[model samples]
Target: MRKLASICLVFLIYFACSVMSAEDRTIYQFTVKDSDGADVSLEKYRGKVVLIVNVASACGLTDSNYKQLKELLDTYHERGLEIAAFPCNQFGGQEPGCDADIKNFIADKYKFDPDLYSKINVNGADAAPLYQFLKKEQGGTLIDAIKWNFTKFLVNREGRVVERFAPTTAPKDIVKYIEKLL
Candidate 1:
């Protein structure tokens, strides 16, 4: 009877700890597709500040955002600021093009060297699981559905969602947040 009590106590402790962990968790399990179509796990960036953006090639802010995004990558990449861009078209078919074309435009126009991936849905029922997780993790003051292209999510070094930036928010405006994370 003593041995049975000990086993039950151990199981209860373990279960309680598991429940606590789930409640206190940040986002460290999401996997997104890299520019090469390979699974890029967020675990690899556990100790880095991540800036995730839903991009659109033909959008009005595309060029400016790409330019500033390039600057951000060049400046803070070594300092652990990771910029992940996901081409999206859900806003207004602004990103209606193949991956290669999107890549070429970014390379030729803005000289952006950050990781760019295939077009993905940023809103609606078809949104990627990663986006779904992001929206849930850091919904804005107004709504969860991304308002437009270039919507950005800032994740701290500990994989905790820190803030959300609208498409109109300049990439330079995010420098302060990056510094805060650092």
Candidate 2:
């Protein structure tokens, strides 16, 4: 009876550990809204290296970030780099516009092609589930909530969280990490 009990306890512990591992492996299994309010499953990006950025149209770093992000996309797109940009007004109300207006402004002002990004919320109670999971995977300095606009998270092709960049980290600076993963 003592040996049987010990085996059962070992089995239980192993089962619990397996469950935790599975949860960690599927951290990217979430459904978030697209810019048009449509459900977007993160699983579609399972085998692609994704750079998730919280963007804002009116932020101080908007122009430079946009330009550099475009350059990054052009540089690494065929090599499996995907940039997912989420527009958020949570920081100083920088992205205060309706979906169409935001889209239009991104196209007209920055000459950013809509086909190159995904826009959504980065911080708030209504923040997308993907962002929520990302923050939990990589909490920022002094807080879990995103501090401001243009904060970036890097995910490898396997959907594992690789690195998290603050709002100030330029898109160009992220290339080395991307190259290493590729």
- Where model 2 places Cα greater than 4 Å from the true spot, the runs are 1-18, 114-121
Against the hidden reference, what TM-scores do the models get? 0.84, 0.81
* Best candidate according to lDDT: 1
* Candidate 2 Cα RMSD after full superposition onto the native fold (Å): 5.6
Predicted structure 2, TM vs. truth = 0.81
Model 2 lDDT per residue over 1-182, tens place: 99999999999999976687633654366766666777777787877888888888899999989999888888888888888877877888898887777778877987776333345666688787778878988888889898888888898988888789998999899999999877
Candidate 1 on 16-81: residue-level lDDT in tens?
Answer: 766865335566777777766777777877899989899988899988899899999899998998
